[model samples]
Target: MQKKYQKISATSGIMTFDLELNSEISKVWDLIATTKGFAQWFPELSIGEPGVDGLILFDFGNGEYEEMTITVYEPQSILEYTWDKNMVRFELVGQDNKIKLRFTEEINEKTTHTPRDISGWHMCLEKIQGILEGKEVSFTEDEFLALFDEYQALMN
Candidate 1:
């Protein structure tokens, strides 16, 4: 899997990543669109409902939750939601017993936090891929920090 980061401007850009998984679309969909499944990789986020205008809860690990709105939804295929000032979308396509998961984030305003967010998402996608491949996955701060540095370099 390769990750693509595009800088549209000093304030806006896009990030895209793709994963080819030997799993059912439904399984991938659950991991991306449902609370329990998403928690396996990204524990801080969860979906509240199953359609557009639904809420995606962001748990701060301190009993506080931020409500993010779902902007698009399609069962076992597409899911898009508001992520802070950006937009995050996951698209799934199945072919020949494998599925391609495309993750895209539209960054409305790139700040100092952009690299951190991108690196976080990069690891989450890898975790998802590992789990789907029947492998146990764990992340360390050092690993994240190293990756974060790599993304931060892109910002420069």
Candidate 2:
């Protein structure tokens, strides 16, 4: 049920996509707004709650941990949060038999931003795109080490 997907690219202060999915708002929300659903793609994540004061703890078991605070949550409508001072928002627009999922991840320091997080979201967004079309997959974290090494190589 994916209608359109915006390719991810590095920007001066952020990296994100404006995605369109052709699925029920409830179903799509369940995937992104739930712990188990998120763990499907971000295997390193251990979500606490989906409330305003909740925290998303993601640890790839590689000595790195990402902590994000949920500042806003409105079921299948709107979700906003902060990660390392970066504001991440998910705006849900309902359409006929589908919903438009807009994701904007803004970080002040792109050069210091973690590529692992970006790549993880990259894979997650791709799977979300596929899942809505009934061709989804379970992206794993077994590639964390390799991906970390790869990112380091790219940076150096």
Please list the C-alpha lDDT of all candidates, in the order they appear: 0.90, 0.69
Deviation (Å) of 104 in candidate 1: 0.6
How do the residues 1-156 of candidate 1 rate in per-residue lDDT, one tens digit apiece? 878888888888889999889998888888999998988998899877779999999999999999999999989889999999999999999865599999999999888998999999999999999989989877799999998999888766
Query: Candidate 1 lDDT (Cα, whole model)?
Result: 0.90
Off by over 4 Å in 1: none
Model 2, 40-92: lDDT tens digits are: 66667666777888887778598888788889888888777886656777778
After the best TM-score superposition of candidate 2, give how far the Cα of residue 11 lies from its true spot, in angstroms: 9.4
Which is the leading candidate under lDDT? 1
Query: RMSDs, each prediction?
Result: 1.0, 5.6
Which pairs clash inside model 1?
A: none
Query: What does candidate 1 score on TM?
Result: 0.96
Backbone clash count for every predicted candidate, in the order shown: 0, 3
Clashes of 1: 0
lDDT of 1 at 129: 94
